[model samples]
Target: MTSISTTSSPATPTTVASAASKRVADRIAARAGDPDITLRERVALRTSDAEVTYAELSERAQKTAAELSALGVGAGDIVGVRLPSGPGAVAAMLACWHVGAAFLPMDASAPDAHRDHLLSRSAARAVIDGDGPRSLTDAAPSATGSPKGDDAYVIYTSGSTGTPKGVLVGQDAFAEHTTAIADLLELRDTDTVLQFAGLGFDVAQEEIWPTLAVGGTVAFLDSKDRALGPAELARRVRELNVSVLQLPTSYWRLLCAQMRGTESPGLSFDGVRTVVIGGEAAGTKDVHAHRDGPLGHCTLVNGYGPTETVVTCTAFVLRAHEPLPPTAGLPIGGPVGERRLYVLGADRRPAAGDSPGELWVGGSPLAEGYLNDPQRTAERFHADPFGSASGARMYRTGDLVRRHRDGTLEFLGRLDNQVKVRGYRIELDEVERHLTDTRGVTAAAAVALDDGTGTGGRILAAALAVTAGGPTAEEIREDLRGRLPSHLVPGLIRVRDALPLTTSGKIDRKAVAAVLADEHTAGEEAGAGVRVRADADAASAGIAAADTADADLTLLLKLIRTLLRAPDFGPDDDFLAHGGDSLVALRVSGTLREHGLRLRPSDLLTAQDARAAAVRMERS
Candidate 1:
C-alpha cells in the first residue's frame, strides 16, 4: 500500500490502504533526490552480521500477512508488537499493517513478565513478534485472543493506578509521525541511520519509520552492542558511519563522556549526516559536550512529548550558548501538523504565557482512549469543551509546564506517579506488575521514597511475601530484568509478609511511607555517629569513606538512607522499597563503592535487609 497525502499539509501521508503492499517498500526507495543510490545502502537492513534486502523483506512481509490472514486476523485488529529490533521485527510489523492491522511497538528487551502483562491487558488479538514473519504462517486459532481498535497498533503504556493502559494509535498517526520527522530531520534517500535505542521507546517512532518513509538505510545493532560501553559505542558510530543516530539521554551521556577530550580516529563516513538526539530531556551540558565532542558534525535536536500525545508534540533545534536553564533544560518548541497545545491551570482554564499549567494537547493526532480503561481515559482525556467540535477529545498530559511568550512550551516534571527518567515516562506501578509475576513474590509494593539523604529523594521498594527463604532479591530481579527496561527496574526490594492496605483494600502508599520512616530512623539510630574509621594517613588521603566496617549493612542501610537524605530509615526498611528506583539505584551503588562496599548496584538490591546485607559483605 502507498502512503496518502492530506489536503491540510502537502507532506501528510495518506491513510488509505494500498492495493499492492509493495507500495510501502517502494515509498522508501523513491525518496531519493537522485534515485541512483545503491541498494546495499537503500532497501536492505545491514547488521553486524547479515543483511536483508528490501525486495526480500517486502515479499516476506506479504507472505507473513497471508499467514496472519489465515489465522483470521484482518483490518481493525489490534496486534501487540513485542519483538526485538531487526529486519524480522520490521517485516512482521509491516505485515500486520499490510493487512490493515495496527502495530503496537513495545521493547522485547523488557522483562517478559511485563510484555505478557501488556498482552493480556490490551486485549490484543495476537502478538506480532520477530519470528512471526515466518513462524506464524500456519494457523493456531488459540493465538487469536481478543481484539480492540481496528487494524492499528495500540501501544499500552503504564497507568498511575499501576495497570498497563493501551492507547489506540491509528496508521494515520504513524504516517503523520513519520512525515513530520522525515521533513524536520531532513532524512534523504542516502541517509544511513543506526537504530540503537529500544524499539519500544517512543523515540523509535521517529527513528525507524521516518527513515523508512524516506528510503534511507537502517542498521540494526546487536542487543549487546546496544548495551556496550562508551568507547565501543563511539567505535560503532565510526564503523557504521551512521548518518542519522537517535538515542536516549542516558546513551548520549555515555557516548559524550567517551568521545570528549580524545583525538579523532579520522574514520571515513561516506554517507554520514545528521544526528537526531532525542528520547528525553537533555542539557546544555550534553549539547555543549556534543558540539565540541567527537561526533562533531552532527546536530542535537530536543523532542518533548508525553506518550498519550503520540511521541513528541514539540521540537527545538538547539543552537550553542543559546540561553539554557540552570536545570540544563531547553524548550519543547511548538505543535506539529494541526496539533494545538493548551496550557491549562488547575481550574481547567487556559494558562497565560509564562504561567505554569498542565499541558493539554488536542487536534487531529490525538489517539482514541485506553482500551478497557474508560475511567482513566475519562480522567486523562476529555471533550475540548472550549473548542468548536461537540465531541472533540484532548489528552490531559499531567505535566507541569510554562508557555513562553514566543509560544514554545518547556517541560516540567509529571503531576502523577509517572516519572521521566532518561526520557521515558514510566509508571512506578509497572515495576510492581513485574514483581507480581515473579515466583515467591506475593503482594508487592514499590515506591519512590527518599532515604533522608541527598538533595532529593531516592527510590525505596517494599514487598510482603510468604515462601521458603522467600525469593532472594536477586532472583526477584532476574524476573524483572526480563520484563522491564533498565530505567524502570527498582533499585532496592523489601520483602514483607503483607503490604499495608487501606480499608478499601487498596495499597495505602502513605502508610507504607510511614513504615519506611520508622525503620529508617531506627537504622540511623544504630549508627547515629560517623566515627574515626580512617587512619591518620588514610584520612589525609582525602578519601570520602575509608573502611568497610564503618559502612556496614546496618550502618550502610542507615548510611544509604542517610546518604539519599531521607528523613528516616531502619534495618528492616528498604532503600528502594521506600522510594529508591532504578536511576537512584545507580547513585547508591556509586556512593557505596566510594565508601568501600566494593559492590555493584546489583549487590545492594539483591541483599536482604540491613542486617542480612551486613553478613553478605566482604571483609576488606
Candidate 2:
C-alpha cells in the first residue's frame, strides 16, 4: 500500500538486442562440464519426489534433444512439451533450445481440446513427456548457432476471442528479461527459488530461468505440495531452507493468516529473505497481516506486468523502514531495465502524472508478438514512438492504472472485460463465446465479480438466453467442462428469458449484475428451505443450538455463512450462486473437520445447495 520509492529515471524504450542471444541450453550448459564449476556437486533442482544435479539435468536435456531430432524437430520448428511442472519439463524446454527449435509448453491439466489447439496451432514437430521422448534415435543436435532473433518459447494466454493466443518471444528478449529479474532479486548460488507456477504460465520463465541463470537452485513443488495447507507450506519452507519465495497474492494471504498470532504457528520465516507477491491486485488486509507479523523480518515486493511483457517489467519493494499507506491498492512501482511504462488517456495521449489511464509498455522485453496472428499483433503492439531502435514496438496493456507524482503506479482495473481468476488471465468475451456455442443457447454473456474476501475472490458468472429446448444449465456447464480449462468454466450459470439490452441493443452487463444481486437478496428473504428457530429456542439465532438434534445442519449452515460472509443466503439457495468458490469450499471442509465431521469439498461442490450438502454430510 505504501508508495514505491524511485531513484532512477524511466528507462529508454530502445532495447540493445544481444548480438549473440544466449539460448537456454547454452546458458545452462555453460557450467555443465567445467572442471572448476563441478555442476555435478551442485544441486540444480529439488521436487517433492527427488533432487537433480546440474550435470544430470544437462545430460537428460541433451538426450531429449537427440530424441526430438529423430522425431523431425529442426531449427525454427515448434515442439510441444506437455508435461507437469517440475525438473523434467524444464529439461524438455531447454532441450528444444539445444536442438535449435522453439518449444511450446502446454498445461497437462488443461482439457484435451485446449492442449490439442495449442499443438495443432503451433504446428509442433513432436511431443515430449517428462519421462523423455517416446524413443531414442540417431538424430543429433544441430551444429548451427542460434541467432539473437531466433524464437525461444511460445506461451499462450487468453485472448479477446474464444481461442488462446500464443506469444512468440525471441531468445534475446527472454534473455534480457531473465537477466533483469536475476539482477533485481540479487540471486546467488546459495539461493533456492521455488518453481510452483505451471509451465504454461509466463511466470514459470521468471521462476526457472532467472534462478538457473545465476547458478541458483530451482525447487519445484509436487502436486501435493502445490495443494499444501498454510501450515504445511510454512513447514516445508523451513525444511527446504528456501531463501526466495514467490506466490500469488491470495495464497500468500492464507499463509500470512496462520502467522498472525504473537507466537509463530507453523511457518518459520527465518530462512526466507524475500517474498514476491503478484499476479493480481494485492489486498491491504494481507499487507497488514504480514507487515508486523512473523514475515516482518523479510522483504515483500509487489510486481506487475503482462505476459506480453515477458515477466515483471516493474516492481515495488516493501521495506521495513517505510509505513504502509492507508490505501486499498499497492503501487506497481517504476520500470526496470530498458522497460518503459506510459499511462495514456482515452485519447492515446500521455495522461497527467496523477490521472488514470491505460498502461502502455514499451521495451526490449516485449514479446515478438502473437504467433501466426499479424492482425492482433498489430492491434496490440504499436510502434515505439520514443524508441531509438528502428521499428521497435510497445504492447498495449488493457490494464488501467494511475501514476502518482512520485512515479509509483497503482492498478485500478482493466479497460476491457478481461479479468484474472486464481492467477489465470481470462477474457470474459472468450467465455461468453463458448457459452453461446452450447446447443440451443441464443445469447450469452460472462461477467467476472470479485468480493475480495475468499481465496478465489474472482468468479466468472455467465448468463444465457435460450429460445426453446435449450440445453439445461447443468448440460451447458458439462459441455463447457470438456471444451475449456477448469479456470475458464463459469462457477455460476443463470438462464434468463432474454439478456437485458441497452438502448443500443447491446447486452447490458450492469443490468445482469443488478438482477443477480437482487435475486440473491430476494432468495435470502424468502427463506427458501432454511430451518427457522423455535419460539422457545433463545439459545440459537437463525440456527439451532450446538447440542440440538439438527446440530450438523446448524453447524453446516453457520460455516457456509462465515465462508461466504453472506448471512442472507437461504438453505435452498446454491452456494456457488451466492458467490462460493473452491476456496470457500475448502474453508467449509476445514470447519467440518473441527466438528469431527467428514465432507469432501467435491461433495459440497456437487451438492450446490446447503440442504444437499447437509445430506452429503449425513451420508458421510
Candidate 3:
C-alpha cells in the first residue's frame, strides 16, 4: 500500500486493497458498481437523450455479462467493445470484466481498417456493435460472473514499424491507477465529471471509474454538443453543473482563446473546479490565455503520461490565484500512487536533480506489455536497476525529463520518431510506412510542423519521393483519405525527386522540414491573392480589392488562408479536406470578431471552402 503525498481529503479513508492483491472488477463492484454498497438511488450517468441510475447501470452491466456469456465469452477471452462514449459503452466494458474477459475498446471515429485490424490482431472472441455473436446491450442476468487481475484491455498505438501495436493493460494496474487518480483528484459524491475523452482513449477510463468510485455522476456530451465551440461547451458545463473536466491540451487552448475575447451569455467555467489537461504538452501560451479569461478562476492541473504508463504518472496543479511557475515548461510534478520516477543518465545511473536524462517509470501502474509482441516489450520494459525491491520493472520511456531541486519534473521533447499531434501520439515511421504504401511511392517521411494556419495549429506535413510522373499530392491525399483518420492525414504533401538522407543513411527529417518551409515561402510569394496583413485590423478591416473579386471577398479569402494555415489550397478546395474542423471554426469566429466581423461556427459549417464560406458570410 502506497500513499500519495497530497493533504487534501474530502472524506474518511477506506480500506482499499493494494493492486497486487485484488481484482479490478471486484474492487469496482465493492467501491462503486454494487448498489448495496455506497451506491444509493442516484443518477450515475447522463446523456442528452437519456439518463441511467446506478442501479439501472448495474443491471445493464449484468445483462451485458449474460449476453457475453451466451456468446461464449469467458475467462481469458478478448472481447472488442466498439461503441460511442455513452452509458451503454461503459456498461459493456464493465460487462467484459464481469465475465472475466479482456476488453478491446475502439474509438467510434477510427477508420474501418484500424478497427478491423485491432479486432483481428486480438483474435477477439466476440465483437460488440460489429459482426459478432451477441450485442452487449441486447439482453437480464444469471449473476454468474468472474473477475481476474490479468489482462483487462488492449489499446492499440502507432508502432515504429508499419502496423499498429496493441498494449496489454492488466485489471490490477488499471484499478490502482484510477483509484489513485480519484484520490488525487479528491473526487466526492457531489462532483459531476464530464466524459470528455473518446471511448478508446485510456483517459476515458480515468474519467469514468473515478467518478463511479466516489458515487459521483458522469455527464456525457452528445456528438452535436461535442462539436460545439468553447462557448457552447462552457454553457453546457454550467447547465449540467459539471465540476470536473479533462480536456486535451489543444482543445483547452481553443477554449481559453475563445473566452479571452468574448463574453458568451451565461457561459463560463464557473462550476468546473478541476480541469486536467494532458495528451500533449500543455502549451504555456494556453496557460496565459486561460489566466486572462473566464476560466482563470478554475484549478488547472497539468498531467503527464504515455499509453504505456496508464493514464497519468505525475500532476502539476496550477491554482488560479497563484503566479505561474518560472520553469520553461509546466513541471510534470512528482510520482503518484505506487509509482517511482527515475531519470537515468547515459550510464543507466540516476541523473542529478537538475540534469536531463531518459525518464523511467517503475510502478504498479505499469501495463502487462505490448499484446502479442514480446520483443518490443522486452526492449521497453526492463528490470528496474535503481529499485531496491526485487522483481520490480521500469519502462524505458523515450521521453527526456529533468528533475528540479524542489522534486518537480520538467518534460523535455521525445527521443524517438513519436510525436503528439492534437494529443494523438503518432509515430512518424508509421506515417512514412503508409505514405510508401501508396502506388508509385518510393520513399516517404512525415513531420509535424507549425504551418501558418492559426486555427488548425501544428499539422502533419510529409515529403515523398516517387517514380517519374507519379501520383500528385491531391491524388495521394485522396488515396490516404479512406485508409487513415483525418488527424493522420498530412496537411501538406510535397513531392520530391528523392528524400534526403543523413550520413548514417537515415531519413533526414530536419531537411524535409526545411524543404517544406522553403516551398511554402515560395508559394506565398508567387501566388496572386489577397495577402493577409500582420495587423488584425488591416486584414479584417479590408484587404486590397482584386479586379476579379470584391474587396470583402478578397479579405475573406485571406482570412481562410490564415485560419486554415494552408497556402496551397485554391478557392474551390474543401476546407475540411485541408485540415479545418469545427474547433478551427471557433478560432475563425474569434479572429473575425477582433476586426469588426461576426460569424458563428454553425454559419461557417454550411460552406465548403474560401469562396463558398466567403459568399455565405456575405449573404448572412
State which candidate has the highest TM-score. 3
Report lDDT (CA) for all predictions: 0.60, 0.73, 0.73
lDDT tens per residue, model 2, 1-620: 34334333333433344523454556678867658766555888887658888888899889888887777677877777889888889889889888778888877777888887777776666678755664223223321123332788888888897778888887777887877788788889889988867788888888898888778899876554435545456677776668899887766776576456645465567788898888888766677788656677777888888888987888987776667754577678877666878888888898876889999998677888888788999999999786566566779999999877777888898888799877778988788888888889999888876544544356577789987777777678778778777778876677988999999999999998777656544444443234354222223334555444356766677667645545555567677555565566666775576577766666677786887887777432
**Candidate 3 per-residue lDDT over residues 1-620, each given as its tens digit:** 11223211211122124553455456445544454554545778988767787777778788888988887678777788888888878888889888887788888877788787777776677777744336333221211122342677888788898778888887777877777788788899889999988888888888998788677889998765435566568777876679998898788888786678556565577788888988777656678888887777788888888888887888888788777777757777777677878888888898875899998888667888887688999999998765555467789889999877667788888998888888888898888899999999999989887655453356688999999989987788878877776667786788889999999998888999888877665654543243634234234434445532355455555666655545545556776666566666777766665655656665666576666676655321
TM-score of each: 0.71, 0.85, 0.87
TM-score of 1: 0.71
Runs in model 3 with CA error above 4 Å? 1-24, 27-39, 130-149, 261-264, 283-285, 452-457, 503-506, 520-556, 593-620
Q: What's the lDDT of the predicted structure labeled candidate 3?
A: 0.73
Tell me how far the alpha carbon of residue 164 in candidate 3 is from the true structure, in angstroms, after superposition: 1.1
Residue 582, model 1: Cα distance from true site in angstroms = 10
* TM-score head-to-head 2 vs 3, winner: 3
How far is 615's C-alpha from truth in model 2 (Å)? 13
